[model samples]
Target: MPVRHPAPTPPFNIIRMSHIELGVTNLDASRKFYTEILGLIETEQVGNSIYLRGLEERNHHSFVLTKVERPHVIRLGFKVASEADLDSMATYFGTKGMATGWVTQHGQGRSLQMRDPFGMPLEFCYEFAQAERMLQQYGAYRGCHPQRIDHFNCFTPNVQASHDFWALELGFRTTEYTVSEDADPQLWAIWMHRKGNIHDMAFTNGAGPRLHHVALWVPTAMHIIHLCDLMSTTGYLDNMERGPGRHGISNAFFLYVRDPDGHRIEIYTSDYLTVDPDLEPIEWQLRDPQRQTLWGAPAPKSWFEEGSLLAGANVQPPVLQAQPIIAS
Candidate 1:
């Protein structure tokens, strides 16, 4: 099916998306897929977890796929401005009634952990350490050397509520959305940014608060095509969920796949940057295929059906339910 993508918007004040983390059953397998096949350089390995950075990025690591026995998100870490910003975020989350914890020795930097209203673990930190060794190898058999962890798509039962929380509390601005005029929108997907770019994180209405997919940006569209060809040769053609197409909003080329545990991962390239504060968020129709895939193949049922659960320690604050937001 041909999917219709939204018209590309002029670049605004968005900064680049920073990092994403995922919990996996087997660290070795996940590492093989991301490093060996995906071309990301493994910068650090701590216990059962592995930290990978795009070959192009000098900043520590961009993707952290951890080997956890349980199927849930350990946390999604974002880079902040300073230690003071981290402290301020901790206080802000606490006042909002969310439990916040601190991480002092992670590869990228010191981080604070918390949860969204529906229970998806979130972390904010500053000061990622640069990796001393950079990987020199690159090829088609080797995964496309992604440049950085781009954006994250999260699922929530109440899209508007989640959107409001991130926007009003966390300082994320919306870039684009899919909505309806009549009944409550079944799916309200919004592109939100922290530092800038199209978005750092996005929220979609679904089952509960869960991690949907982690995206990695490549240097070019050909790299994405090479990735698709490599996947076909590796007998993992079925893993390609959608795309090798353009996005109407960011004007980037994109391709999505599923990991062994059903976690969604995307390979993308050429999205424009946002650099202004006066930029308005773009809106799209719920039925618009362009909103998801420019060439269009409907997102798989599994894409709509699955998400990462929250970690035990990061449950959301109870007061979130009483906030003046409607549930989907």
Candidate 2:
């Protein structure tokens, strides 16, 4: 089948991502892993759930680990331009035959939730409460000192279909793509963005619509090494999936880890900014080792196989398929 593409819109002009809700089998263990090992500060706690953010950020919370009966992703919250946009989006998706749900007076703002055709959970809102920045004088080596939750990558069996839903219905633009050199012209990977910085999200051809990893941005490369060392000392070295390497495309330092539920989370830094109207999308050959890792180490099998499931009241089955080659 031919890959379906979404209609392009002007780049997003608003605040960036706010927080990502992660579902964990054991909320306490997951909270320790993030707060103690990763050095994120706990901002608030409501019953079994805990809200966290980097010490450097003043946002209410950048990461929310919720206590769910199972392991999965609850929803990814993006700060919209205004509450009006949220209502419009809710009606927009409704017109397209997608169901929409609303949450009033929630954590940061009143929000609306929906699912894509492939079953990924998405939420949009404008009611977030801001906090004071807390790391002004931590002096050079704040553990994991991430500024904000940046982007996420997901796997989709029908990459083209998922791309169309995000790009056409939502307002996302393509920043890069991976094309197979062999026959069939299959899309191996696609980097997409909402407003700027090359990509805020990406899609890879894989088993189903699963979240591959959520990328958090740190101020410098040293923070990545510090966090890796911390993970090692805390006896969580086994969680380190890959990393402390430069990416051939983003030119950023990256480290990947598998949380308790096997969901991958990336600690990334130093990628260049993309704010120009004419920024060209980068295309990498599927067979190039440089495409996977700029420093030459191959990504482990687990990193390729594991990801977070989407969450909502009515969860959908994943679009299953055989695994493809590792990007390199």
Scored by lDDT, the top model is: 2
Model 1: per-residue Cα lDDT over 1-328, one tens digit each: 1111222331221234567777889887788778777788877798877887877677777777777787666777777667777787777667767888987757757777777666666777777788744434334225766776788888777677777766666667777776753354333567787655787888766666677788887878998898999988987788887777887657778888877666788888887666577676677776666666665445656666566676753323222121212212
* Alpha-carbon RMSD, each predicted model: 6.9, 3.1
User: Each model's C-alpha lDDT?
Assistant: 0.69, 0.73
Residue 78 local lDDT, model 2: 77
Top candidate on TM-score is 2
lDDT of 2 by residue, 144-197 (tens): 876667788987776777777676667676767777775556667777776577
TM-score of 2: 0.89
**Per-candidate TM vs. native?**
0.83, 0.89
The count of residue-pair clashes in candidate 2 stands at 2
Candidate 2 residue spans exceeding 4 A from truth: 1-7, 10-15, 137-142, 312-328
